[model samples]
Target: MTNTNNSLNSASSKASPKCWPILPAAGVGSRMQADRPKQYLPLHDQFLMDHTLRLMLSYPKFEQLVLVLSETDPYWPDSAFANDPRIIRAPGGSERCYSVLNGLRALEGMAAEDDWVAVHDVARPCLHHSDLDALFSAVENSAINNTGACGAILASPTRDTMKRGIKQPDGTITIDHTVERDQLWHALTPQVFRYAELKQALEFCLQNHLEVTDEASAMEQVNKQPLLVAGRSDNIKVTRPEDLALAELFLAQSLNQS
Candidate 1:
């Protein structure tokens, strides 16, 4: 909405930015068909969100973490890091974008305009240390290489054949066409960008009634290009009942590898 060029120029001139991790954990996963939110459901003896919180706080160390939670969420107090000094709590919103924006606002006093914010999903409990390392490395290299890349995200190439679906008159679905997977990347979490640019980009999208599914989408609306660094395919977001098992296995695999 504002002068994009001027904002970018000013940000590039600032000192190296620190990455702030923001995890949006407000969704009540109805698809999981569980009694409670998917994030609160048990995963390997602890709440599902506990694994994600631990992963974010431990790897690629930061001063603090902003956890966006629903205002009425009674389960958060039970989290292992609930009383941890490194954690900052922010109220969640109706949608993912709004929740992320609230998390950004939580750092108003501490975060500078050029500071970087890495938005990751709280449901993704199996994020590997290697993926975090790759994502941050790309962000740091972007400036050193003078690539002018506004942001960076962890993504993976689509391995399976993609298809476009079409609804039939009889309430059935059929393949409309086969989509090319060559240039398509399955966007993953830990999408990082400057604090001010991300905030402004999100605000502009909300003002114009645009649908922002992720932080990258908001940045795209402002004509900014983000680098897609390849990441492991196992970084899955636990949304359904069966995903809990998969996440458990992935977590175990990561632990064994470590």
Candidate 2:
């Protein structure tokens, strides 16, 4: 894949009912204990966001990439793709849902309501191409036939026993009960949805003051059951400091395979 970035103006004529990627990178990852946002942290020799942008740009399916960053973000200007035209910037919101909404609004005239939008986490730098293919296939088959909801998320089934915990006033924690793990899945990113459907779902959640932990939850409030496409477990979100090393390993493995 070429490293060159195309401008949104140049790709407008080619835009149609195709998938677009919305990347939200506005969070201050306190857990990372880093001087800058985790997305701006260096991995190998480049910023983490660069790895992610390159991966998404490598995919020919996406028409353009919408990147939402905080208004006060200082690290973005230093990014390798800071001047890349293919990437359109959207002002980040206070919350993740709001940021995603802003990105959708940025594509107002460019993307049709029925077009697919894939919302991915900027911290997830190791998203494999095969997993992306699976998500696209699942969304296309289900959305086109109306056999399933147009929204779908890449997830992995829980592998370990789950539990509910109760924090005592003394700062001690106790298990409330052992929970059944069957039918439970860990939701991952690059959640795909119809442009209009996702926008409406998020608006509905905001109106109702409901908590939307992910895109799937917003759709659920509207009684939409999004399909879950199983993805590789290594598609990890870099939250803590240790996760960065693991992501590097995964990226290396992917490169060897390619």
Candidate 3:
């Protein structure tokens, strides 16, 4: 039941890359405090969700792109993402973890549980097509008979010196020793993982009552080392007002490159 209208038949269906279901159009933008949810906000002529969706939709080998969002969300209709025939929807959950869990449920006992699933943030729209190439390559190389973990995330080395700033007993400011830049690396998305491993990692976190932020955190809970692919530094999350301007700049750069 995979869509193939927009793509040609693959020689090796089992070996071909699987679909990447992105979690978008969720959460209240407390930081942006925009007129609507940040994912629905307009970025140029396209919605924030469009940028991420378009990137995946452009790939020919992918069979589908499942988008998870709140059922109560006012924006976006079933026909909104019509260009991509493989696009599907699922109800979102309370937290990001919950939203992702619901997304996983939509494919449970349906898709190959050990196949690949990529989860990305809607606000991070700077992922170029080349970044996906690196991710896919890593997944193809690592995954062995569906049991190998093929988790790949974009990250960059910290250039600036970082310190832990804390308020002393008397409310005095204290800056701790400079953190080792080489040892610290910033993680970004879209984080790709094997379906079974991703589910196991997430379930382990929830079952143990662990408050995890990203997929990598869940993997860490299971002693899995996610392979970090150096992603473009421009791929940053848009959370505040000033970040909008930054996003625009990155988008413009992408356009210029294209």
Candidate 4:
């Protein structure tokens, strides 16, 4: 997991051979309104996809990186990830869950049955090393016998009063009520889990005809309330036009810190 620019060492010489990172980058960024996907958007010197790749490639222990992507993307044949010896590409699916399934399918041929996969979105570029540390700590105990577990996105708690509203056809909104400010947590990605556990959850969803929002929701369908490792607010998702600027600022700050 190293090149001339990156220095990496195994956490243990024996090497725990299971856990890896899987990135779902097949989404065409409709919100960005660009012909290209949001992941192809430029952030500083590297493309947004590169930012995501850098995060995992920067880590030393992950043996392989499975990128779930569209075959049609121009970024294909690109060296950002293809240059790495440990990087693998898997064709994406119709939905995020399905894309993950395709990734798991690729892993199924080679990885251990109980291997772990940390699923992350391509748009989230502000993930920190501390957040990664916290997530591993939460499930470190479960790694003992390979009965690995589920863990969710980290996000800062809400400090502002959340408002509920009704949108009218006239382009006006009415505040229905002020939602409770005390109980809210925003979800961000790099959501980690056992590959088999997630595969089970997705299979359950497919059988039950459920369309869940996040990976955690699919797991919840299977009676799993994943542990959340609170990540910083700076870890943001670029889902709308306005978020690009916010993301730019976060990226600037992130580089300065590093």
Q: Pick the candidate with the highest lDDT.
A: 2
TM-score of 4: 0.85
Give candidate 3's whole-model lDDT: 0.77
Clashing pairs in 4: 155-231
Summarize candidate 1's per-residue lDDT along 69-132 as a digit string, tens digits. 9999999889888899999999999999999999999999999888889899889998888888
Q: What's model 3's lDDT at 237?
A: 88
Model 2 stretches astray by more than 4 angstroms: 1-16
- Give lDDT tens digits, candidate 2, residues 95-209: 9999999999999998888889999999999998889999989987885587967678999999999999999999999999999999999999999999999999999899889
As for TM-score, the candidate ahead, 2 or 3, is 2
Q: Which one wins by TM-score: 1 or 3?
A: 1
In order, the Cα lDDT scores of the candidates are 0.90, 0.91, 0.77, 0.78
TM-scores of the candidates in the order shown: 0.93, 0.92, 0.86, 0.85
Clashes of each: 0, 1, 0, 1
Model 3 Cα lDDT, one tens digit per residue, 166-245: 88999998996777777588988888887888888888899999978988888888888888888888888888988877
Candidate that beats the other on TM-score, 2 or 4, i.e. the better one: 2
The TM-score ranking, best first, is: 1, 2, 3, 4
RMSD of each: 6.1, 6.4, 5.2, 6.4
Model 1 stretches with alpha carbons more than 4 Å out: 1-14
TM-score of 3: 0.86
